[model samples]
Target: MKTRKIRILIHVAVLGLLIASCSAEDGATGPIGPAGPQGEQGTAGADGADGADGADGADGEQGDQGDTGTANVIYSDWIDSEFDANITDPAAGIDLDAPGLTQEIIDQGTVLVYGRNIVLPSNEIFPLPQIISNDNHGFRVNSPENIRLTISSLNGAAVGSRVIEDYRYILIPGGQPAGGTTIVIGSKASKQEIPDYSKMSYQEIMEFFGIEE
Candidate 1:
């Protein structure tokens, strides 16, 4: 036989090399081999804790009382009191009628003034009287007689000099028409009208009202 046909062609070439190595993974999958280079980005997550405070809006409607700017005059909020005497013949005023002051409101022609100061605990610093309308007569806005401050004259004051005169005021109602004003004096002047208390000499009118013995 030729050696039995060379062992049947060497067993058919070893069974065709074991059927091409037993492959069933088709050849079309070879094109997907180029996609290998995308894996490096994972670190950004930390900011979530701030949201709880929103509910407060509803209360606005109470307006309707305008046009009294300076309201004719009345800004007395520093009515300090204390006068150990020395302000001759009239020592009982500083009572702006409980702040609503009325002598029919200074005879209805209003124009009061007093930012006085005569301190002396040995600190000695007198000369702060400002009772308008006249000086020497000291003070006078005593309408209808009810202690409406008729301080007549502190220009002769001297009850021994343990001195301690403190006062405050600013009332100017009575038609205001003297030009330019902003109404100030509790804060000490800016709103004009109420300047005329001159006339010195009772020791310069008691050092001009701040008095001293």
Candidate 2:
């Protein structure tokens, strides 16, 4: 009986050890523990490369050529009249040679004559057919074949022949019609009117034709 009681006591000790090793019915979870401190930040990465440039654009088309301009206009420098003779005869007039006056100019083109008087104050320039000191100061195309221009003074008060020092002439290529006219000198769409030079002053005429003094 002493042996059996010892064996029973050994069995009870083994069962208690097994029960402690096996997990008991899970109990209610305990409160969560406090969080740990954060770790130090890592070093920053390098920046990316820049983008490439774009391709160039195509070229545009060229424009058309323009029309020719007024290069045909002609002019003469001031020519001395050399008229020192006293005019006792009203019909007789002084003649001056104008070699630049071509047949085409007299027929299809226009001729303008300007004269400066020696006796006049400030050496005033006057257009032909101007009246001075009660005298009819005028000119006439004597001979188109010879290109001669005649200057005459008529109906004067016997105040010694109105002194004429020099003369000038502008030869416009295109004929000026009876009435004012317009022509296209540039591109087909543009039209410019021809000014009446006879009515224009000497300075105005010079400026219009781009002539130098």
Best prediction by lDDT:
2
Q: What is the C-alpha lDDT of each candidate?
A: 0.45, 0.67
Cα TM-score of candidate 2: 0.58
List the pairs of residues colliding in candidate 2. none
Candidate 2: regions farther than 4 A off? 1-70, 145-159, 184-187
Using all chains and alpha carbons, the TM-scores for the candidates as numbered come to 0.24, 0.58
Model 1 lDDT tens row, 72-187: 44535445554435544334444444356556555543443444444434543222343433333134555432223334444544323323344444454553333333233332
lDDT of 2: 0.67
